[model samples]
Target: MEFGVFATMAEALDAANKAQKDLVNNYSLEQRDQMISNVRKEFEKINDELSNFEFEETKFGRVEDKIDKNLGGILNTPGTEVIKTRAFATDKGLTIEYSAPYGVVGAVTPSTNPSLTVIGNGISNLAAGNSVVFNAHPFAEKSSSIAVKTFNKAVVDAGGPNNLVTMSANPSLATLQEILESPYVKLLVGTGGPAMVKTLMASGKKVIAAGAGNPPTIVDETADVERAANELYLSTGYDNTLMCTTEKEIFVSNQVLDRFTNAFVESGARLLSEEEANKVRDLIFVELESGEKVVNKDYIGRDASKILSDAGVDVEGDPRVAIFITDKDDLFVQKEQLLPIIPIVPTPNFESAMEWAIEAENNNNHSASIWSKDVYRVTEFGRRINTSIYVQNGGTSAAFGVDGTGKDSPTIATPTGEGITDASTFTRRRLFAMANGGNYIL
Candidate 1:
């Protein structure tokens, strides 16, 4: 029977539970590795097609960027290698400690990263010997269903169980709640906004939640102005700035603000006038009944040029990013605008820049970056921000393993303190002891 797609969450969870049992009882570690390898290879073969499908379905983010993200996540995600076993031998007894799966993991993926999240989570969870039941965002159900089906096919091709990865044919908030409260789900992993994270945290299960972030980027006077501008534009403008790691606000040293902004314009960034900036801001944010300004859902992840045009600005060619000078107090500077529009704040010194950046980060502690030549300033900024992912003199993409040292991960669990989760993150350490085994030489 086909187990990848089911009519209800209960069926998906049941299939996942049975599949996890099969994985632990019948499959060897080497066989699990084979399954992971098959998944990576299968995803690489169809990454471009899946990326294009997600873009067409959700109408969010750039297609090329989606391809890059899905490819990197599939290829670079650490698999069974991260699952380690340790042995302690003594004269009296021998003890073995190793990582064990959490059984069926219920995953809640965001619309912004539909298939990428499902595929990455599947690889990690399956590598750790667990099965998965996915509750994809409603806006991305069809694309995410394809991902679930792909994982099941790849695993089966490698002689793995058929229901290793499963999901509901139709996903919704109701199904998500069912997964959260289901007794069969041993662990929960979710990636989305604060509300989603909060719901998972309250589910009374072991949870790994990747929440919202308003990452800040700082440019100090000691930095390379031109290089900083180019890097900032590339990162903040990437995929229409959909990644949670993307720089939402920028703090630049006043001594080189003009040069930095000018260089950014030269690098295909659209420099908006104060009037145009205000118009764009008004277009993207709305004041709530509580008098609090929040980002408008309609504008999230829209192209920079399209946003400018919608705001009545006479946009030219194709601007990769839109920029404007703004005070630290501006609503746009404080909020997380997933669009390519960026607000640059000028600061008097390195210390003030760091302070303002931390303040604007709002204690999310998700991701932050600094471009500075001075090691002392870099160190200080890193200590002050206390973000989960910190980049020094580089763009935020580096933190996502795009031409950098970090590994690719669709779920960055900042709130739960598991940064860039892998196979090990989904497992629990288990111990086995043998009395008087005489395994130790000493």
Candidate 2:
């Protein structure tokens, strides 16, 4: 039998609360591992369908990108492996610490991630001995429901509770508020924009909020220009820059600016003229009555060719990224667009370049990358920027532990200060100590 969704938020919360108790009291670590493994299997089975559902339903991001996100969320996201019990032994006594779950977690997933966020949160939440009630973004409810169903089915098949992973058939702000206010929901994890993050923080519950980011990728004079350009463009274009860690701005040292531009162009990045850049800017961003600038949303994460065409530029091939050379003070250079549009700023030296990169990041402290052979300069920039993710000689993928530290995460929780959350991040740490106890074995 297929999995099902709850008719009301009340029903979903009740079912999830019971499921959490069952999961914590009845299931062992081994059982949890089996459930997680089965969840991965389910993702692999319907990877193609889930990706398609997300793209067609949300009309945001590409199918291929969704496939990667699905795999990452299901298999690569940190689970029980990242969660650890710390122990210290002395001559007199032994002190140990344990990680415990917060019972039921109210996880609000975003439209940008939808199913990916649901599965990723599900794996970690369950691994930490908690059940989740997903409050999906309304824009991608269908796809998110499919993901929640997959998680619940896989968990049950692997000998877990029936409603261990559940959600409402229809998601709304009211439902989210209900979940936030419910006593049955012991903890909260939210991934979305600033408004959503602020609300989660104000819910009076312990919350892990993954907020906004405007990541900057800086290239210094010491780096290989062509390689940096190629890698930078590839990273910026990935999934049309929908990922929070995607590079929004590029800061290049003037010494290598020309070569970098040539290489960037060769890597299928289209450079927009100043006149064209203004037009593209107007097409992408809109100023409100309060003079606040926001993205057009419709064009966000769309194909670069499609966005460029809509912006009135006729192009033959599909350009991977749309880069505009603009002043450091340009509005396009300031705000986070979440689109394939990239702004390039040329600095006289690496110091000025780093400064510009830092300014562009705007203290979000989420993600930053650099292509440089100068270790001193890289360290200097890294120290000053102090972002959660720091990538060197590569894109945000590498910073997500791809070919680097290997500490990948779908939820880079910035506002909460728990960067790159895994199973450990979801658990509460408790200490146990023995006063003057005997040592057992060697």
Candidate 3:
């Protein structure tokens, strides 16, 4: 039998509402900890299941990579950290500052990293003492439901409310409206495209919308070309580049472009044949809804050989998809093609490279990658670009603990004015003051 088989979004919402009421009236810190433990355990059990579902449903990333992402959410992403309370005695007697839950939370999950996103947000919300109502993407409803069910079962087995984590079976336009319009939902978190973010912001409620990103990775002449190429390939190949923080474009200095290209090719990357390259260009550079040419989904996440074959080209063995040495003014350089294909743009110097890189990034502020030994150059680039993560000497994925020191969380693209979404991002602070036999000035 398939995993997700719930009745409807309304039924799920009702159940979650009841559970939230019960939790507010009876939940405890011990139970909360138990829920976290259960969530972690369930994550392990369903890791394989979610991975299979993602590959079967979306086919946009590798199953192994997906498993890693889901596991990371369980192990990291700040679970159950205390925000602590402090009391200070002043002329007005006593004042205290404490962090509290925002009641029931409504979260919109995206298809790119379905299970991981839900698990990460759900764990954070539970740690912050809030119940959640998750509205999964229509394309990822099954995986999303499985994650929610697994999480809720774990919570219930751990002495918490059964429906503490709830989700809709079939999420539609009307169901999303219900969630957004419901006054019971205290906080709203969305992860997807620009339209979704815009809608959440216009809902007249507090929202954390993780939106679109077109990150540019700049490689200067002074950088280690081999290391930069390796990092770039690994980051972009991670889950087939489903991550918004993945390096979308490459800006290389002319002095090192040839060397960098050689290094990239040596790292199992093959340049596309003329016929294969043309096919990729046609498939990716397609007409958008507004009549603008955009990258199509067919080419996204496919293996190089498969992409070439699909485009009616035959190769002896596994051949990389379209790879081209192009000028910065080319359409490919300006566009964010979420596929295996990468465009190498040459710039005269660091200044020109940085300028083109920033323009290519287009101020998405999601993430950017830089490879330079010069401390000042890295610092200067970091200061100029307002990205949530500026990864130096590595790929964009490194920022999310992919191959770096940071803890893993689906790097929130919207950033929502908050650089990173973790434990503190899920709660609000409230202050208490007392006036005991002390006169205070107004």
Candidate 4:
């Protein structure tokens, strides 16, 4: 099996399959845990350098946010610890549950989160006793390669087999399709956009996919305006809004619109006039001949200065957040603007705000948030939104368990209804039966 570089998808598949046979398929629980720990250490050792490389290679995201994302994948992403077994007993038989692996896994990662996604998915896949073959994004090929090589080395250094994680040198649609068609690749794990997820699902293999989102946030009259503003600014401003869970739009109840606005402005945020907002919008989103507006990828994860400079505005120093006003029907509110730009909309009441926020979420069911102290209103909002992840009076980072508060997951499978993915998401349930056993719960 190859060690560091793979020239083609076939090589990646072959190496990963060999690793699965030599290490993953036969690893004991203790051995798997040791390897997982080693991977985490290796990640931390190179996280700072790797994060900088990720930013340099992809030209997206803030180095600070990438560092945090790398650590989140290590500390928060669930491993074998989340894997559980269930048992039941009847008069005639006893049944025990086991989390069975999917053999070799084919993972397709995005440029936005190259190393982060690889490590997060690698931890879970290894914990589930499956070797991984990666199809890294072309723009992030170098960073992804470094991460994969370090990860594989970590496993081997911990007395694990070679090719525990393998990837090709350059990634393309052809290679991704090739890996998906490979017989050794038993399952697919995708962390990317809609088109990539669609392709993986259509491959006739079982898939755990995490896709796009235009997350929405609401500020009600009962909320603490300052806290809300700070949290919102911190999230969207982080890494120039590269996170899928970053707040794309905000809906504030008209009752506290003035208060929210003042607080939002005090939090190092600069609001553009209606005319300026139009200019910024035009600069951020380009209109096609087909009448559809799309985001300019060049500015997708760029900083505030770059985006604002393009909008014909000059700033003294680096500002944290750049916000503008937009109506519900505005293009900024309709589509996802994956930059430090956030759209604020005014709603008449709590109900209207909730409706507007939910509508802005676009049914991706990925993530949403609200700022409110009212217990009843919070409960109502949570129930109505029913999103995969709902942050209450907190930033979008809460969805990733950033401070050890919420659930940690790499694959937030919204369509499959497995909200926050973990080691359990990668495995199937198997039953072990004993003929003469006892029924306890019954």
Best by TM-score: 1
lDDT of 3 by residue, 1-442 (tens): 2122347766666777777778767877667777799889878887887788877887777788788878888888777664467776766677777777888888888877888887888887787877788888888887888888788878877878777777767787777888888878888988877788888888899988787788888999899999888667777767767777788778899899888888887776766655566776776677867988877767677766676667776655653333667777666678776676777788888888888888887777878879999999999999998788889998776666756777666537454876668766777888777777343434
TM-score of 4: 0.96
lDDT per residue for candidate 4 within 210-295, as digits (tens), equals: 88888888898888987888778788798888877788899988888878777777888887788878888889888889988899
Using lDDT as the measure, name the better of candidate 2 and candidate 3.
Answer: 2
Error of 1 at 13 (Å): 0.8
Candidate 4 residues lying further than 4 Å off, grouped into runs, are: 1-4, 436-442
- Please say which candidate is ahead in TM-score: 3 or 4: 4
Tens digit per residue, CA lDDT, model 2, 1-442: 4353798999999998888898888888888889999998988899888899899988777778778867767778777877788888876678789999898899888888888888888889888998889898888899988888888888888888878778899889999999999999888998888898889888899988898899988888889889889888878888888999888899888888889998999999998898888888889888899998888988988888888888898666988798878878887678887788889998888878888888988989999999999899889989999999888888878856666666556688998899988888889988878767655244
Task: Note the Cα lDDT for every prediction shown.
Answer: 0.89, 0.85, 0.77, 0.83
Model 3 residue runs over 4 Å out of place are: 1-6, 82-91, 273-276, 313-322, 411-415, 436-442
Candidate 3 residue pairs that clash:
210-414, 211-414
lDDT of 2 at 86: 89
TM-scores of the candidates in the order shown: 0.97, 0.96, 0.92, 0.96
Candidate 2 has which clashing residue pairs, if any? none
Which pairs of residues collide in candidate 4? none
What's the CA error at residue 170 for candidate 2, in Å?
1.2
Each candidate: how many clashes? 0, 0, 2, 0
